[model samples]
Target: MASSALQVFGFTLGVLAWVGMIGTCASPEWRKNSHGQTLIDNTLKYEGLWVSCTAFVTGQTNCKDYAEFFVNLPQVLQICRALMISSIGTGFVAIIITVLGMKCVGLGSSNHIVKARIALLGGLLFGISGVLTGAAVSYYAQGVLQDYYNPSFAQGLTNVP
Candidate 1:
């Protein structure tokens, strides 16, 4: 009925969100600004949680892991890395709880109220994880914006987006 359908829908959405969280955490384009655009000497660069990479149009790529220069990294990036990983853990917990609480599942069949409570708890956890993810992204984005608008950063830029 309606309850079962809604539960299925929520679970499906949760799965999608989990995938998206993983992508966001792993993406190297969280903050990027590239320069040059020719097949021979083009330079493409991007920064991620763990490393920063620069690629040449000749198919050469060089990456420097953050751990090597961890002390020099901005505070926001450090916080972002921690939050993203924690959010993934929270999302996993939510999915497990929701699946067990589903009506079609046999894990928690003692009482309807108990199952419902578990499902509600899962939903709440999803909300919490979402908030944490949002905060992390926003914090990093703000830093990027600040850097983009700063005079010192603009002084050496050539065609940035």
Candidate 2:
């Protein structure tokens, strides 16, 4: 029972950590153009607000993939002990840190309509990626449960002596 409690707590904490990371990473400084509508808000480069969407798609690099970072840390830390949720915490912090970097580049002049359309497109992408990431994590956790926590997978069978 105690172990179960611990596991439950850890999993709950992990979920929170993941969401927090995404939120932090996704949010950018609310920078507004002369028109004052928030050209760069919450780390989103509103389309008509396309500061540099091309830079993103070139594929040579990606602006700190927040979701991937959040999703991969927990498993890696199992190899050691000091990490202790650092993976999760780091993910959240990383996005927060990088947003500042991206903003420093500054956006080019884009119309409000273009920015709104871009923001809408970005929202769609974010939704799809978020769902895919969540599903992947769920599948991973299920695998862990089945392989390690399931009694039938281990030596729970009783001896017929």
- Global fold similarity of model 1 (TM-score): 0.85
> How big is the positional error of residue 68 in model 2, measured in Å on the Cα after superposition?
18
lDDT tens digits, residue span 53-158, model 1 = 8887777899877764346667877789889998999999999998888877889766888889888888888888898899999988988888888887778653
* Per-prediction TM-score: 0.85, 0.30
Candidate closest to the true structure, highest lDDT: 1
Each candidate: how many clashes? 0, 7
Model 2: per-residue Cα lDDT over 33-124, one tens digit each: 12224432323321110111212222342233223333343442222212223334444443333222231223532454443343334334
Which residue pairs collide in model 2, if any? 28-42, 28-43, 47-118, 47-119, 48-114, 48-115, 49-115
Q: Which stretches of candidate 2 lie over 4 Å from their true place?
A: 1-106, 148-152, 156-161
Q: Model 1 segments beyond 4 Å from truth?
A: 35-41, 68-72, 156-161
lDDT of 2: 0.35
Clashing pairs in 1: none
